[model samples]
Target: MKQEKGAEGFSENYWLENYADVDDMDGMYNARDHAHYLKAVFALDQIAIRSIADFGFGPGHLFSAALDTFKPYRSLGLEPSASAFIKAQTVLKRYQPQLLQTDLASWCRDSSQHKRFDLGICTSVLQYLNDQELAAVIPTLALRVKYLYLTVPTAAEQQRFVEEYQFVDQYAYSRTRQQYRELLSPHFTVVSSRLLESKQFYNDQTSDFTEDLFRF
Candidate 1:
């Protein structure tokens, strides 16, 4: 069955067809990767973070691992893929984090929910967004959270994998590291930056990744 694509060209149906099972989601970070993520989460000491949000939280692995490191009063995981959301519900049931099956822009546009988060995490997901979506989502994220942890595949990294990897029915755009910094500089203060290597989150391969900490 063909999967439905969102307005921004993200295909929830495609992900469901390929990775309906939680085990099939290799994008979820491994134990070592989770440790690295936790270290960044705890680095923000300006405020005691009581609430957190995870954009594009596929299969809830990062969120689940986070529960062991820190307990926030409220946690929200926003995922566009319905199948991934379903798997997250079961896998993350113990943490009780609120899971939403919608893209970030739609969630941000809701006038009813004025809730804001202390920290937001977006890992291994930004490369899938096109320019227009990035323009809308980045500002919204800045407005929604005090801080953000964003991870993306750099242009150099994307180039290395272009031959063997591609998203099904989604447009994955790559930008130079400088371009990304310029894109975010107007909306956030860069606090830290680092590079990470990971096994393919969607395919059976490996990739170089970059993570940045930003204060909104």
Candidate 2:
């Protein structure tokens, strides 16, 4: 939550102020990303999950697919962003209306209150965290969730962040696949992982967004 400049340094507040407003919340960009994540979730044994927790559920748009596809006993979207929280509530009224507005640290600390969710997800959100945050958050989630789904930028993708877009404080580290495995090995088994390469069109050129999904 601290504000600073450089990679791994963007405050949650900065993101909130800058990205709160958007014309289309769910469009081509989001849809493509969502498709990959949804595929990862579908690979799991759906019968094992009674409820789902979208750990970094921004605007809760992605949870819409889970609600429709899994039909869990219940679904909860957690977001620390007040604006995102509010928007998620409004955006997903017909989907999973109940959302828990608390940061990951707080949510994990009070796991007894959220002991029932069988699945936990944090997609496209880890790139903002620094090494410390990721270390603290991952194990906590592994303990609480029987299954976990997450996405993060690859090392190559991290390098492409424009100077102004650099924010590393949010992510304690941007790790390689092997490093990621070493970090998660003590807690849960890695079920599957695959790199997702996507293309985005700029004014007259194409930019690539390389992300990968990890399931534990």
Candidate 3:
């Protein structure tokens, strides 16, 4: 039944049993190593992020790191699993980030932040959303963000993950990188390495960000 809602199979035990050492084991923290690299990207651009939103911040590692690293003045974190949300709260005690134990749709309905975030993190999140939710979220995020960091494994990548990376997630939708890009292109410019620039921030003439060419 929960999967029917959006393949939300997470719980406190799911987080506790699956995650370790902030990017080890069953791949929580949205792969923290990847999150760590973003600091360099943000610094290269000299972006002073004033606001941030983290969707599905499992175990709170990435969001906590973002709070300390970027020091955004306004922040919100959302997790659909109530049990995981409660457990993750322990890690976030030092920061007063607004948190909601709700899925993206619910949060979207209730959010009053008219001002767009300077950065948004939705890593490992979109693949769990069904088609309807995906359709809604892509454009909505474009309107609400300047830049976004997101990740959703393609089927081929998941094959490698299961075999070698110790990864396990039954909820992710099977889609290639190309398929995902088709949905995002109207709303965002898919930048390098799981990063995206919302149409609000994309410029046709500027290649001022990272020079690394994006690949599948």
Candidate 4:
């Protein structure tokens, strides 16, 4: 088996040197934002989130929130950063979720170990992948879960970051929302701007979504 890679700049060295700087990826440390994300998922109340799979959960902060809200019996998370993975172990100890120290590609390849999951969350993580990897994972993720909540920085956001260099994480790419949606639309229906309903499993008849056009 090939060795898995840790986060780009999140090795144990970073934790020891800059322990106080909590914003490891620019502006990715906000609990309120997480609450907002869960609020949308909860409102969907359309689907029961019994099982969750978070591809890159960082230190498991958002994953912990999901565990609390859904109270799912089965949960799994993958965080490549050694320090983040160690921190996640403690943060998610109560839930006892199965955590992995691997990247999304590796996990996607070996994900048949468990059956399909109810919800999949991959926030701000996909922008870090290259084009081919991103394309490969989209269909894989579509097949693995019933619902998905994803967030990626589009080309417009990248341009904004270029003008104002605050939110620029040097390790990430600036793929367009249309590019991502084109890839995801093949397997999942747009639930909202950042949400998706899998075509393979979601069979809602009463939702007020014609989906003639999707929002950003």
Candidate 5:
């Protein structure tokens, strides 16, 4: 494993145990809803995607959806937590035989075995990392993928979550659309961006906004 700032600060089991409890985890601030993401995949021409990668692929929801819909040539999932990776592995068994588990920064550095991808998706993940970590990770992700799909929290909502959730460093940072472009422009062309008024129907009365989706 490549060394990282406080790389050993948090244990993977802790995250898995905590995330297993939905109430303890940040639920309201989820990424694009499963159904809507599926719609986005269906609209894409099947032939366009050959290989795909999902960074911080939580619970394998997006990964499963991609495999089910696109049937891409290959799908790779990268996760930091052991517990999350275990669950993701169980859910993504159809592709498990080919799955690779490693830290994104370290993996990207090793070009010999780990190669760049055709498409990369990071949903509801980047908003959780601080500016420094994002700076380190996003650029590498950009270099590794020809196309990238990212989901981020709305400015106002992210602020609210940071205050309400009382997260120390992670989830306290948010970036604007322009900032995203600036970060990725050096490595990729901004293909498109759309503000999705993500509606989370939690028993109808309890609905919330996720964020915008930036496709590069």
Candidate 6:
């Protein structure tokens, strides 16, 4: 499906309004989501990981968690939302991760040392991109990092979520598991996948989301 610009299209104003109170936005992803991401990070033990690149590093929680657990030598985060970026900087100040106010594709294109990470993380961000955007970014991510950990709500899962919860967020594009895998196949290999159950904010809505590990 073609990407549609939703009512609030991830613009500066949208983030400013929604994330004005960072405390209120902290519960956007429940504890279950945090556990799932931590589990994914634990799976990286088989491979030696010294550096990490995080895309859409919301609130810097996942990156911070990884740092605390894995203690990678270097970590970098790219966030497009200015409000979230500012919060992440403060939240992750102690960790001292290199943070950038840009998207993944642009960062990869402009940086000479972009392809220097052992792992790449893009959690809860793919659904916001349309097919074309995904096509453009996935390849760059594959080329830049040796491995990628991506988490997104698949089409079927999202359909059930919307129907059961009456929660509608138009900013995201729902795609099937196959569609997501296809987009990444050209540049990476799917190493593993798992379903992560989590709750939405307002209604306590639940869904078994998909998280995939890819080797580039």
lDDT of each: 0.63, 0.57, 0.73, 0.71, 0.56, 0.63
Residue by residue across 86-189, what tens digits does model 2's lDDT show? 76687668764468777676676774764556666677666555577668877777666666666766565556553545533343346677776666666655
Listed per candidate, the RMSD to the true structure in angstroms reads 9.0, 10.4, 3.4, 4.5, 9.7, 9.3
Q: lDDT tens string, model 5, 95-168?
A: 65255556656555666745656667776666556566667876667556655666667566666655997533
Q: After superposition, how far is residue 7 of candidate 1 from its true place, in Å?
A: 5.6
- Candidate 6 wrongly placed segments (more than 4 Å): 1-45, 194-216
Give the TM-score (vs. native) of candidate 6: 0.72
Q: Rank by lDDT, highest first.
A: 3, 4, 1, 6, 2, 5
In model 1, the worst 10-residue window by lDDT is 195-204
TM-score of 3: 0.82
Which residue pairs overlap in candidate 1's backbone?
A: 3-13, 27-201
Candidate 1, 10-94: lDDT as tens digits: 4555565445554534445373365355556455433355787888887677777665456888998888876677877887798
Q: What's the true lDDT of residue 153 in model 6?
A: 80
Task: For candidate 3, give the lDDT of residue 211.
Answer: 50
Report the lDDT tens digits of candidate 6 across residue range 114-188: 456766777777887766667787767766776567778888877876798554446678788888767766666
Residue 101 local lDDT, model 2: 72
Which of candidates 2 and 6 is the stronger one according to TM-score? 6
Candidate 5: the clashing residue pairs are: none
In angstroms, the error of model 3 at 184 is 1.2
Give lDDT tens digits, candidate 3, residues 21-123: 4445323534456556777777776756788888888778778887777778898888888776887799877888889878886666656857678888987
- The full ranking of all candidates by TM-score, starting with the best, is 3, 4, 1, 6, 2, 5
Model 3: lDDT to the true structure = 0.73
Error of 1 at 6 (Å): 5.6
